[model samples]
Target: MKNRVDFIDWLKAVGMFLIVLGHYFGEPFDQFTQPIYPKQLGVAFFVFVMGWGLASETRPQWQVVYNRLFPMYFWGVVIAIFISLIFMLTKGHPAITNYLPFIGGINVLGNFFPSNPTTWYIGTYLHIILLWALVMRKVNVTLPLILLVLFCEIAIRSIFIEFERLFTGYMLVSNWITVFMLGMYMHQQKDNHNNLKALLIMVLWALLLFTWASLLNPLNITQTFPFRLPVEHSTLISSLVVSVAISTVYLSNTLLAVKFFSGIPANPVVRFFSRNTIFIFIGHMPLYDVAEPIALIFVESGWGKRAIIVFIMYVGLAVVSELLHKAVNIDKLKKHLWLRLN
Candidate 1:
């Protein structure tokens, strides 16, 4: 199946590009730029891709779904462990709160609930995956799922707020459902309705969404006190953005200005990307920090060098992640690397 959709691989390429870009802090356009918030902003794109991927797996055999997910997540644990171990030994264990925020992220309970800060994504991801398998499974995904999650959380906010709680889970639920369903809807349409006119509607919304997201961030609408609003900041806007991006990719089946971005997965580039996508994802964070000091050196000497550094960091991540997955023979890796409880 890796030979199936090159378009996704191209999207993976785009997502991977953003991963490195996110780490960088682009300067204020002095012939070179490094932006600190790109990653946070760029994250919705990747997360949306994840939802789209899930949506594609409509009623996939249980065995197949389990097989695909387990190895990737298990390796994430291994990488995170090595990361923590290295930091602990070298940095003298850092602060407890700083080093470990989510759970150990090893076994089911830890991974399901999450603790270590870096692995927060694990819990959040698992949260959605569980929903995908259960509550949202084989269901016709429409706007209601997103609205239900958001409004339910909104209703509970006053009570939860006193516990110093917030509605983060709702954000994930709302965003993934809308985006993933859109992706699934696209996959369904791909069989019979790949049309340029369809792509046009998607393009219009895509541009509109980008503008909305950019504007809200500038306004910091989500940053105010009481920290809770009737409608959350950027949640609705991001949902629209993610949905349209999914639509654009699915409809036109084209990547903008990038040949490598076209086709089914079998193309060596897509296969390489789809196969080791998780590895590159889990490994990039630690590796990206290492790149920053190096980027600084180039930034100080020549602004043009900053882009080069970001490029190097991205390529280096792909290479290293590919090598590591190869080393593990991930295809034959253990089932349930995480200890699960009944």
Candidate 2:
């Protein structure tokens, strides 16, 4: 279990890095790594890791929710206010909406708060965590349940499209619950020597994803072929199939990663990123949004500019996150809060 925890930390480090890189470089990075969606894979790693960790949790459900969410809520409001203040000083008009609790304090309801767009994950995560705690965690992990969840996800997405409502970030619980459940199922499995089977499954999913990508964009003219999957082919079935395929491939690869790194110790840098992923995830985008214009002025080439921006955003966030962690001592805070509540 100790080694496995280390392995998951490494996985998170890699996932967080990919997400940060993808956000900074966007389609260009996606084009560079064709056939594999790095950002989506990163998200898959996170969702799977969450499910994996939750499988063995012995804490009360409310405790789990509080532990996972309180820090996010605290930091979200702080960042939102900070960004709003920056906007006020720079643009001469305060983003008054960001001062509100749900709109900016939590910053999780879709794109309602522009201060930090990446936090839609928080809302979706809240929904899925609640669902897991209230319902899914108690039920047996079975084929029928998985299929039902997948079908529900597809139906939900289709209904959203039909109603002309943008699904955005907040309402993605249905989209991601299947992957999360799969992670939990994998954690429940006792077999430790399933590397060959895992590899085979990964290959099959990769093939399916490749075939789907080829079919969707035969000419391969679009740079975001596999990663973005052209807007025209956004059918409900296609979207769900592609999403599941990508997630399966990543999940399978995660098993392979665990097998490969069985006895190895986690790298310090990787461990740092893994431990502070929430800070990096929440902090980097806003940092990038503020710093890019200032940093890009010194660079002429496209790749050079992106590299500079990512370097600054990542390193700067790491420093600030470390300082904040030291000052706030979130673990101690959570324990204190829990004691008071109890």
Candidate 3:
């Protein structure tokens, strides 16, 4: 087997692009495209990849957490402080609290700095990593464990609802943990594929896609679907179902990609996006805000306009992210910090 998987990089690039493109959509465009391409599916891809990549990790738990999270936390603080200063100068009131590390999610600064709300994934991702390192990694991949995790996730959400203290990051953890575990399961079972199993998995995946679409109904195509749950419970169940469904679809696609495309040489562009995903993911939103007005001046509101704007924002972010990636050298910084901590 090859030491590296090129298809995984391609998938990450695709996921990052989908997320950025999703954020660019507004109003009619979002409404039009959401049913066909839910942005949350991009997140599912990342979480799944995370699980697969880390399945065989042998590093100490704290070391793994530090290696994964510290660079993000470092850059997050820097960006948060910079944005806060900008707010001070422009809006004349900065959210001082945003300067603290992980005060909000380490990725987007916090709710106060809403420029990149998509960074909510940072907190959720961090929690998932912590959980996996501390607990999930120790367990054997089995049906019972998967089902138990799912049950615990649902139970946690139900309790959160009961208490009315719904932490978004924790809730998202509950939402995506199963997908993460499924990733681990996939890694474990990568060599066990057969025609019958593949066919069954595909069939189940199709059913999930249908169920997810019915639940989301982004187009409002049909308000009344059979087997709909009661109103109060519907929202919770719907979110979980949609997450699982979308994630499973991506999982199936991942299997196909690995099977067919893993040997292909990596595209430079896709590899760039994959490697710098976190940077671009965090930076794209703020850059989009700056690019949108200028882009709108050149085109009227429509699908064409949205595409143009997204393209401009994507290119601009790529340039900025490339520069930052070269200048900062996160790996070096992480090493320096690790030494100091030790």
Instruction: Report the number of the highest-TM-score candidate.
Output: 2
- Candidate 3 or 2, higher TM-score: 2
Q: Give the TM-score of candidate 2.
A: 0.78
Residue 193 shift from truth in candidate 2, angstroms = 11
Off by over 4 Å in 1: 26-42, 46-51, 55-65, 94-118, 142-175, 191-271, 296-309, 334-342
Candidate 3, residues 1-342: lDDT per residue as tens digits?
346566578668877777777766634323222322445556767887888877878888788888888767776667667777877888887745444337544532222324445556667768788888888888788778877876776566454433334334233577577768877887743333355655666566556556655655533332111112223444665545433433344445445544433434567877777777776777676556577787788887777777877776666667777798798787898898899999
Quote the positional error of residue 204 for candidate 2 in Å: 8.7
- lDDT of every predicted structure (CA atoms): 0.47, 0.64, 0.62
- Maximum-lDDT candidate: 2
The 10-residue segment with the lowest total lDDT in model 2: 161-170
Q: With candidate 1 superimposed using the best TM-score fit, by how many Å does residue 167's alpha carbon deviate from the native?
A: 8.5
lDDT of 2 by residue, 1-342 (tens): 333456577668877887888876776444323334556667777887788778777788889878887887778768777887888888887665444444423433333534465666666667767777898777777768877876676566555443334334224565567768777876753324445665766566566546654654453434442234434545766555545444455555555554543334577787777777887887788677666786768886587788888877666687778889999888898899889999
TM-score per prediction, in order, is 0.63, 0.78, 0.74
Total residue pair clashes for candidate 3:
0
Report the candidate with higher lDDT, 1 versus 2: 2
lDDT of 1 by residue, 1-342 (tens): 633555555566665665556445333311110111233323444455566666667455455346645765676657767776777787876333322322432222221222232344554556566666776557766656655643444344333333333334223343334444545444433212334643664566467446544644443222212132323424544333323333333222222311223322235765665555566666665665576677777675464555766666667766777887677666554443422411
Q: List pairs with backbone clashes in candidate 2.
A: none
